[model samples]
Target: MTHRVLAAMIKHETNGFNRTPTTLRDFRDQNFHLGEAIPRVYRGTNLEMGGFLAAAEREGWELIPAVAASATSSGPSTDEAFEALCMPLTNTIRAAGRLDGVLLGLHGSMVTASHDDAEGEILRRVRELVGSDIPVVVTLDPHSNVTPEMAARATAIVAFRTSPHTDQAETAERAAAILARTLRGEVRPRVVLARRPMLTGFDGARTHHAHGPMPDALRRARALEAEDPGVLCVSIHSGFSRSDCRAVGPSVAVTGDGEDPRFRSIAESFMDECWARRGETTERVLSVAEGIAAAREWRPGEKPVVLGDYGDAPGGGAYGDGTAILSALIEAGIPGAVVANIWDPAVAAQAVAAGAGATIRVSLGGKHDPEHGGGPVEGTARVVAVSEGSFVFKGRYGTGTRGHYGPSAALEIGGVTAIVTTKNKGIYDLEQLRIFGIEPTAQSVLAVKCMHGHRAEYEPISSRCLDVDSGGITSGDPLLFPWQRVVRPIWPLDPVEGGTP
Candidate 1:
């Protein structure tokens, strides 16, 4: 008999320091597809929704798609946006005559205005409607803050082992397979979690680092599953520390065959490793001046030096309206440099109005909070190109996915071209530049507003990549933000002995 399943994607990575409140419109600006539109938008994409769709076809399950809504990282999500994401699933669960299993795609770090542990809240509601007997398996981002509530509610949980998250679809497939096996009575998986009192760890979950903590942890996790028949899946969440929630730190969840004492032991061991390697970090974030000097040193004939605006990473809930690096480039007169992008809808509008080749003086970026990534830079620029700012992803990070930056314009100032956008989203794919007629290989410097995800695509084309501390909400240093919500005595926040205190 074919099993009936309910599937949905509700995801967010809240950055507590950001002032912007995420709303439904924000989800629409990034990814929002309800009912049938879910398949239309994400049937073959590289997201969790795509994996669920594939599972339905492969397993002969009656897949019920409810809603897939994910807003870019920002301050706490509004109650309304949270409701919009949960209601579709709840409404569908209420109406669906029966559901054999539930497959969810969640970013384990959602902090809404009403609830700090938002994904836990989503699972709580799901359990409320479905009860505990039915199987519920979830796939989470590697950066999720895996709470006890999430581990308790979920029958099985899996997270991307890869940091650039190149394995999003693969991670969901693993969760779906576990659900399938449980429904078939092949296994009875139960999840157990263990976390340490730390703000961050696991080398920021960078799988690209061959000797990083994540690679070592993931190797051990995979070995556990291979050696032990009781272990179904092991998920290691490095946690989103930018989200000032109590559970905002590294955790490990083991989905075992049954209620085995060994599952908790496995999770505890993993957490111990995380705590032991709390101080190990692979990337070094340099100051704005250092990034500018690197850009200035680049020659015209060499591969572009990718200057990363680490602090103002949009993917980590930064406002993305930073002018620190842009200002530096202008000050140093670094010719043949490109900044893609600086989020400023107002200046983008002005560029769109002025049209290509029209010179206009405008203040760009740092509109959200001048105290963070520097105030706006006032300058005259020639509009080189203007676009609707929508494109398809060709990078390994988000292959087969569609992305939009809203109205965007290529403005040339002091020989440096800036891609100004109406909406803020991290730039990971080279298609972002190709859309504006800027080839990634041709530029002397490609300063991007991104965190680590860009390493997947940009690193190959870049001669060298340097992390820049522009002082936005996504700064690598956790001490940069004012902390009030996260549990006290956490690592880097207060002095804590090893492991759970």
Candidate 2:
């Protein structure tokens, strides 16, 4: 029996605080890979689409292709635009008649003009169209807000466990395989989620290195999974609290059936551990000086130390224009370095105009909000390489997902090289540089704008990495931002003295 499975990707992570609404232009500006334009291999890596195709091939199923639309992180999507995006897919699903299963790639943290729980809304509508019999499995970003509506509406949800989300394709493969297993009656899928009260700041929730409580919880999950046969998947979702929603904060979810009490017990155990470890997570980050010093002192090793500048990640709806870290690096005169994805198109154009090897004075970064990091700094730079930013990768998770760097170029100021792109990407892959003739392995210092996932690839080559204290929309200091509705009473925000509420 050759079953038919429909697959599509619609993703947008909305930072409600950001004034810039996610529009069609924003999507086009930030490397919108729509329909067939999506890369066969994105930035030297294969993408989730490859995983779906692989799974379908194994199952002897016919995979129906629909539109896959992904925009960079931005403010809330306009209601009209979101509806327009959803209707086409929804209408397609409605008209498709009976389908065996559906697969969707979604960023779980999307908050649009129409709904706070955009993924949930999508799933709920899809559920209405597909009914109870047809199963729907979704692959999500680890930072997604796991709402009850989403949990109830979808049959199974698999997400990238890593924060920088290096495991996008791996998680997609897991979801697709799981969906196939469910459809084949090999395993009955069930989801039991345990909720925690405390809310964590973005920086404190990283799963890599000696990161927040999530890593320890993941260890516990591994142990529990070994003991319980019914536990198919254990997801420790450190909820994206930036979008003020009811299902905020960290949660533990177990997907399986046959043992309700056991599932609840395990879920609660992990949830309790998350709450216990919340006090250890802090927002008092190291200064840029501290970061530079730490990076210099790190000894050469098998795994490079990864410094995550979560504060200035453009993926979190940041302007990606901060100059604080660059200034610090320039002052330190660190050699053999590359700080990627500075997001200065004008500077890129100026460099392009100057032609390769030509020396030109260009303004770099700080165009979005100069007040945060003192805006752009003018410097004499040489164009090192100009590229279309093409590469293929079987990602760190080993899922063979293709990624992209769009139209990218590299600029050198002093000894440091900076990658300027027309697109805003949060994750840093080797292909991003390798495609442009810049090899990261040759560099002593690698500064990238990402929260955590950088550890998978960049960590292997780094001498030392430090989460540089920088300023942008995703600043690690949660206290700096004023929130009207975040379900607070945690960390520096509450000032309870006990650390986390």
Candidate 3:
């Protein structure tokens, strides 16, 4: 029998420490697509309709597209905005009677003004509307803080394995397929969550070789998946503790048979491994100054120096407007440099007003959190080029996806060209610059405001790259921030407990 399925995608990863509160306006600023707008804006990559369509075609199930809304990482979403986003989906589900299954794409770290567990709240509402027996599957970013509520509500859940998250579509397909199988009575879905005290240490937790203990744990989990005939997938969620929610920490989830002790044990074992490798994971990192110094003198032909601007990382709930690195480069007189996407909507508007080739005095960077990034760099820059902000993915990360910078321009300030945008998108595609008349390959130094995801794309083009410990909300150092809600004795915060307090 063909079943009817409902699907929607609404995602946002919030950093509680950010000064600016995320609102519906911020979503507009970031170029978020509501239900119908997704197809027109984002085409292929992680398209909400694509997942539902793929499942419907493959399983002969009727599909309904309700809503799809996503905003870039920021502070807790206002209560009004959260409800505004979720209402459309809940209303559709209510009207649909009963659904055979449901699929949702969630970031898993959304902190709303009224709710800390935004995903869980949505799940609870959806479960109430659809009832508990209907299979619900979810696709999440690896950075998710998987709450108990989420595990209890979602029958089958999968997380993108890579940090750059190029596999979003693949992960969504897997979740949808799993839901279809469960609905067809071909498989029963089960889940168990294992918690670790320490926050998943700074970046690279997604890296294959540098992942340290994660690779081994994943290997063992895969073995368990093979051994247990019922086990379909095992996921290690390196939780996003920057969210400052109650359910924040690393987690292990195994999905297959209902409430299997073996599955729970397998997940627990992986959590133990994560706890064991806490010492090797370094959280506090070097500053941009330190990273620049290292890169300036880096061996002529060494590994591409990846300069990860943790402070301004768009993926990590930052404003992505920090100018510390750009200012430093100017001061040091670093020649042959490229900086992708300084979020200066105001400046972008000014440039559009002035037109290309016109020299103008513009304020760039530090618009959102002036105190953190040192409040705007004022300068007269030549607007060499302008675009409506369209670029193709040429980098290793997001290779197949299309990126829109949303009214972008290249502002040349001496030897360096700063790619400015009205939208806040981290540098994951090389075309982000090339499309705006700035090619990164020819540059001696490139600065990217990203957490770890930038490595996948920039590493291929960079002669050398280094992660800068720029001081901001998403810093590598966990101890630098005062986390009150996180479980006690997690890593460098309380080393005596070995991060298990």
Best candidate (score: lDDT)? 1
What do the candidate models score in CA lDDT, each in turn? Answer: 0.89, 0.70, 0.76
Task: Rank candidates, lDDT, best first.
Answer: 1, 3, 2
Residue 144 lDDT, candidate 2, scale 0-100: 74
Question: Model 3, range 163-206, lDDT digits (tens) per residue?
Answer: 66766777778888788778868888977887866666323355
Model 1 scores worst on lDDT over the 10 consecutive residues at 492-501
In terms of TM-score, how similar is model 3 to the real structure? 0.91
Off by over 4 Å in 2: 26-46, 186-188, 201-207, 210-212, 244-246, 281-285, 295-307, 393-408, 489-492, 495-501
After superposition, the stretches of candidate 3 with alpha carbons farther than 4 Å from their true spots are 28-43, 46-49, 201-204, 208-211, 282-285, 298-306, 392-403, 487-489, 495-500
lDDT of 2 by residue, 332-440 (tens): 7766667777888788777777777988888889888776554787889989988775555434642343445556678888677888876666656677678778767
* Top TM-score prediction, candidate number: 1
Better TM-score candidate (1, 3) = 1
* Candidates sorted by TM-score, best first: 1, 3, 2
Better of 1 and 3 by lDDT: 1
- In the range 286-333, model 1's lDDT, one tens digit per residue, is 999888877777887889999988999999999999888888888888
> Which ten residues in a row are the worst by lDDT in model 3?
201-210
Better of 2 and 3 by TM-score: 3
